[model samples]
Target: MAEAFMKPTVILAMTMGLAVSARTVVAQDTERPERGREGVTAPSGGAGSRWGGPGGGQQPWLPPLWTALDANGDGVIDADEIARAPESLKKLDRNRDGRLTMDEAMSPRPGGMRGPGGQGFEAGGPQGQRPDGSRGNERFAPTTRADGTLDLAMLWSQGRAVGTGPVRFSHPPMRLEDIERITPYGLMVGGHVCPIDHGYFYPRPLTPGQPHFDVMSPADGHIVMISHRTQLTGSTEQQRDYDDYALHIEHSATFYTFYDLLTQLDPAIAQQLDDATRDRFARRQMGPPIHVRIPVKAGQVVGKVGGRSLDIAVINTEVKLPGFLTPRLYGHYAWRVHVVDPFDYFDEPLRSPLLKLNTRKVDPPFGKIDYDIDGRLVGNWFREGSGGYPGDGRDPRGYWMGHLAFAYHHVEPSVVIVSVGDFGGQPRQFAVKGNGPDPAKVSAKDGIVKYELVYAPVNSSGEPIELPPHMRGVQGVLLAQVLENRKLTMEVFPGKTAAAVTGFTTGAETYER
Candidate 1:
C-alpha cells in the first residue's frame, strides 16, 4: 500500500532533493567544462547519491536503450514514447495493461538487461546477483561484443533487467488522509496575503491577473462564493477588496479562501459551459467553484489558478465557549488575549481520527456529536456575517475587530479585541448563559441546542455614548452544536425561537475547542 501511494521515481527524485534532469545536467556541464559528462548520459547526478552513489550500482547503464525509447531523440523518456514503442510495451508492460503507468514502466523485471536468455549483462533473479554468481551490489561494467561497442541486442537485454530496488518514492495523493498527514491545519506554503503590485501592508490596492494556486477541496462542502478579476467595487474596502475565491466545505465547519489568483482563462474547448455556471467565473475565465455543492472527492482537481504564489486561508467557523465560567467577586477589567491558532486543534490527534472509524453499528453516527466545552477562551474568534469576515450578508467596510479573547471568570467576563500595531485597551464581556429550560444545564441535545447571549454596544465599556445602531443592545436566539468534536458553529437568530431549522441568521460564531 505504501508503494502504491508513492509517486513516480523521477518526480520523487526531483522533489526529494536537488536532483537535476538529464537536460539540466547537460546545461550545467556546458557552462562549467570541468564537470562535463563523458559517457554518462543518463539522469545520473545528484539523484544517484540518494541510493548508493553513481559508482555503487547507481549508474545509468542503458544509453542505447534510452536513446531508442526517446523517439524524438530527447534526453528524457516520456510516457507517449513508451506507449508507442512495441519494444517497451512488450518488455515493460508487466500486467499487459496496454497503457504505460509510471510504476509499471519503472519497476524491475526478473532478469537484468537481457530478457530471460538474451545476454548483455545478467543480474540475479530479483536478488541483485550477477550471472557470474557475484552480488550485483558492487558495480560491474557491462560486457561489450567483439566490436568493443554496445549494440541494439545488448542494449535491450541490459535495459530490461535494470531494477530500482533501493530507491523508494513517496508522494501520496492529496486525499483527506494524505492532506491531514501533510498539513492537518492546511498549508502555508505560499507567502502571506498579497494584493498585487501594491506594497506589502494592510489595505493594499487590488488588481487583476493576481496569481492563485490550484487546489482541491479538503473535504466535502458547497462552493458558496468565488471571486475572480479582483473587485466588487462596493463602498468599503471590505466590499472593494473583499474579492476572494472560497470553498465552503465540511458541513460549513471549515472554509478555504484563495487570494491573489492570476488572470489566465482556461483553454478554448469544444463544448461551452452553461450560463449560470459560466457566470460564477471572474473575467469570464473557465474553471473552479463553478457550481454550488458539486460533491468532489479528495485529491480531485477542482480548478487551477494562473499564479505560482498562492495564499490559502482555512477558516474553521466552529467555535465553542469555555465551560466552567464562574461569577467573579473582584473588580472587572478588560484583558487582551490572543486568538487560538487555527491549526492548534490538529495537534490533538484525539480531536480528529486519522482513519475512518466503523460507524455501521452506530445508527446516524457521524453527524453532529455532543461537544464538551472544557477549555480556556483565549484565541481568535470572528463574528459571522461580514464580507471577508465570518458569517454572511454584505456589510460595507467595518473595523477588522481582530481576534477576541474572553476571560469569563473576571467580573462580567473581560473581552479583548486584537488590533494593528499597538495592543488594544481593556475589554468588557457579554452575557452568555445556557438556553436550556432550566437555564443552568451546560449541555443539551444534538438538535435545537440553545444559548442566551447578548450583544453589546461598546468596544470595551458598557457606557455607550453614541455609535452605529447596528452595534446597539440586541437579544437573539442561538442554534448551536459541537461539530466533529473540534469546534462549534452557532447561528444567532432574532427572538427566542425553539425550532431546529431557521430562515436566516442575525449573526454567527465559530468557536474552536
Candidate 2:
C-alpha cells in the first residue's frame, strides 16, 4: 500500500534533487566544486537494496498503471512528455473496458495512487489535478527500473539498486545556527486553521543582498517529487504572484521528507523539469509536478529559499499516531495522518540545534498534529454530512469550510482555540472569550457553553501573534452544545457580543466526530 502511494513521487524525486543528466555530469563536476556533488552519481548499492515492486513483496492483480502512460520513462506527463503518451495510453486498456476509471489512471498496479492510510485517489483534487492541489505528494510517470530504483544512468536503463534501508540523517535540512525562530509543527494560524499543520516553517536572517538561503538534504536518498504552487503577494491592484516550489525526497521505501515554499531552485534541479512547467512557474501560474529521480547525499545543497520561511514535513508510513477519530476526514490532505515530529526524527546533535530554534515551550516543544480524543471537543469536527476533510466532492479549495476543530493554540498550548469550518458562513478561528471551559473538560453535562470568537492577528510571516482576550477585539459569539461523545451543535453570531446572542438560532448546524 505504501509503495502504491509512492509511485506518484519517484519521478519527482529525480528532477528536483538532481537534474544533471549523464551528458552534463562532467560539466557539473566543476560548476560548483564547493557544493560537494562533483561528478555526482547515484550510489550503486548492493542487490539487497533493489526496489522490490509495490510494497516490496505483495503484488496486485493488474499490470502497473503508469507504466502504460509514460512510455519513454522520464517520470512525468507534460508538454514535452506528450510524445510518448499516445502509444502508452493506447495500450492502457488493461481490463479491455475501452476506458479508464480513476483506479486505472493511478495504477502502478491498482494501489499506486493510494494516499496515506491507503485511501483511493478519488477523494483528492478536481479532475486531472493531482491531490493536495498543485503541491501534490505524487506526480510523474514511473522513471524506475524493473526493480523500482530510478536508473539514473538512463531514464529507463537497467541500473543496479540503491540502499533501501532506514538511515539516520547526518545533517539538518537547513543551517539552523543562524535561524531566527522555528514555528511549532501544528500551529493553527493563517490559512491552516483546521486539520492542523502537517509540517514546520523555518525562518532565518538574510543578508542585505543575499536573499537565497541554502536548503539541504538530511540524508542519502532520491529526490522523487516536485510541485509548483502559485502565490500572491500585496494588494489586489498591485498584487504580484510567485512560484513556490515544493519538493519531496524519498529516503527509503517507508520514509520521506517534503520541503516547499522555495523561491529558488538549484540550476541542476531546475534544468531537470520540462520547459513548459518551468515557464508556468515563471509566469506565476500553478504548475504541475514534474517527475525525476535524482540522487542526493546528506548535507547536499537541495535548493534555496528567499527571505521567506521554509516549510518542512516528514512522514513515515510504518507508524501512525493515535488521534484522528476518522482517518478518512484527512484524505484530501492525506499526508496529515503520518506526520512525525521532525526534531524527534533527526539524530541528536542535529536535532538539538533545531529544537533550540523552535518557539514552542511545551513538553514536546515541537508541537503535535493529532489532537483528537473520541469523546472530547479537543479535536476535529465535521458539519453533519459534508464529506469531512475532503469536502463534498465539489470544490477542493473551500472544502475545509465545513471542517471544525476545537484544539489548542499551536505555539501556546495553554490557550484554547474554537475553530469553526462554516462559522457564520465562513471558516475562522478564535481564542476563547476568557480562555475558560477548556475543551479537554467541556462535555454534554456542561450544558450550552458560550464562546466569544475573536479575530487573532498573525505576524507578516503567518505565525499568530500572542495576545490577551481583552486586547484582541471581539469579532462574534459562538454558542455550542455537546450532545454526546460524538455529536454536537454550534451556531455563530458574527459581530455580536455574548449579551446579544441569547440561544441557538434555527440556523444552528449539527457536527460529529
Candidate 3:
C-alpha cells in the first residue's frame, strides 16, 4: 500500500472530537455514579452489576474500575474488558493485590534499572514463563478453567528480555534531495502560489515574461506534468477528464495575520498597559487553542474539452481547529496533485469567460495524458492557535503557494529509485523495495533506502519538532473521480485497503484538476 500523509489539521480535528467525547463521558460518570451500576457488577447471573457478584463487592461510590471496565452499556465485565485494563495494573499485582497502593507495589531503587518492582513485574503476576522459566525475577502462567476465565498466576522464576523486531517503514520517507524539477516549456496560463510562511521562490529570477515550472520523476520512470497557459480570454466551458496516471504539481503560499478586535481592550486596567502588551494580555485571557481539520472532497467528469460535466464524492470532511484564542498559528500551505484515469467525456459550453478563461478557445482532445494543471486555495488550519486560549477568534490570513514536484512508479522489474533531483536544486527522495505488495513488510533497516528532513513550524523561532510515528508518515491508495458539474474528489488511505476520507465536496471542477 502507498503510504498516506495528511496535514496536521486532520489529526487535530479527529482528536478534538474524541477529547470532547471523552470529557463528556467522564462528566456523565461523575454526575450519575449509579447510572451504570447494573452493568459493572450484577447480582448472580441475573444481569447483575459488575460489582454485585459473589466474587465482587459493591462500593457506594462509582469505583474507578466501573469507569475503566464498562466500555459498553451491556454490563458485566468480560475478558476483553479485563484485557483493556492498564498494563501497569495487571503486571504489578501477581497476587491480585485488589488495589495498587504505592507501598504494596514494587519500586525501582534510585539508580537501579528496575523500579520498586522489577521491570514488567510492576503490574503484578509472575515474570516470564518461556521454556527456560529461570530467566527473570518473575514467572507467569496463564490460567484457564472450563468456565473460560483468563487469570495469571505469579511464580518465582527468571525472565528473559523481550525480543525486538526489525525496524520497518510506516510510509515511504522522502527528502528534498529526491525531488526533481521540470522546466516549463508551455505557455504561461493563470497560476497562483501561496506558501504558509515565506512566499514563492522561482528557480531563475522572475522577469516580465511568464515563468513555467514542472516536475519529472528523478528516477527516470514515468513523468507527470501539469501546465497552465497565461492569457486573457473568456470563461471557457469547464471540462472534466481523467487518465490512469500519477499527477504532480508545486504550490506556493504567503502568511498573514488577522487580529480579533473584540478581545483587544481590558476593562479592569483600561489604560495600564501599552497597546501591544494590552493586546497580548487580552489574548492570554482567552482559553487554550483549538485545531480543526478541513476535509478535502473530490469529484470527476468525462467529456471532450469543450463539452463536459462533473460528478462529485465527499470522501471526507473534518475541522482541524475548534474555536480558540491564540496570536499566531502555523500550518501547511498545500496543493493537491490528483492521479486519475480517463473514462469518458461530454459536451459543454463556457459558463463565464472572465472568471474562467478563453470561453471560445478550441477544445483539446482527451486521452491518456499526463497532467492538466490548475490552481486554487484548498483550506487552512491553525496550529497551536490562540497560543492556547478559548473563545478568541483571531485567524491569520492563510494562503497556498509553492513549487511543484512529481514521482513515478513501475512494476516491471521491481526496481524503484528517484531519478530527477539529485543533481540540482533541493529535492525530496524516497525508495521502496520489497518482495510482496505490502510495503510494511519491507524492513526499514534492509532492502530499503529512506531520507529524513526537518520542517520548521510556520512562524516559530524554536527548534523544529521531530515528527512522531503518527505525524511522520502516511500510507494508502490514491483514487480520484470526476462527478457532474466538473467536481472531483481524491481519496487517500493509509494502506491499499483502508477507509476512505469522509465529508467535503471533492468532485467539483472548482477544485479538481
In lDDT terms, which candidate is top?
2
lDDT of 2 by residue, 1-513 (tens): 222223334533432232222112111111111111112222111001101111010001112243343332222233433444444444444476556455444432113334212333222222333232121222212232222223221211112124444567788777776467787666554334574444555556666886577888888887765655553211112345556677777777656777877777787776665554465457553322444466778888878886777877676655567776665444324345556777766787777777767777566766787777766667877787775543442322344566777887777777778777566555677786678678778777788988877654543234668877766678888887888758888888888898998999898889886
- Summarize candidate 3's per-residue lDDT along 1-513 as a digit string, tens digits: 011212333422332343233222221212112212211332111111111111011121122223223333122444454455454233333356454443223231211223114443233323322222112111122222222221211110011111221111111111112212111111111121111111111122223553222211111111011111111111111432211111111110110001111111113222422342233234331111111111111111111111111111000001111111111121000101111111111112212211122111122211111222222111211111121111011111111111211111211112222211111222222222231222222222232212222122211111235656754443332232333332233322323322344322342112221
Cα-based TM-score, every candidate: 0.24, 0.64, 0.15
- lDDT, candidate 3, equals 0.20
Task: Give lDDT tens digits, candidate 1, residues 396-476.
Answer: 121223223222211112322111100121122333443123212323344345544454333221234464676444344
lDDT to native, each model: 0.27, 0.54, 0.20
Report the poorest 10 consecutive residues by lDDT, candidate 1.
Answer: 329-338
Off by over 4 Å in 3: 1-195, 199-283, 286-474, 481-489, 497-513
Arranged by TM-score, best first: 2, 1, 3
User: Lowest-scoring 10 consecutive residues by lDDT in candidate 3?
Assistant: 308-317
Per-candidate clashes come to 32, 19, 160
Model 3: how large is the Cα RMSD against the reference?
29.4
Which scores greater on lDDT, model 2 or model 3?
Answer: 2
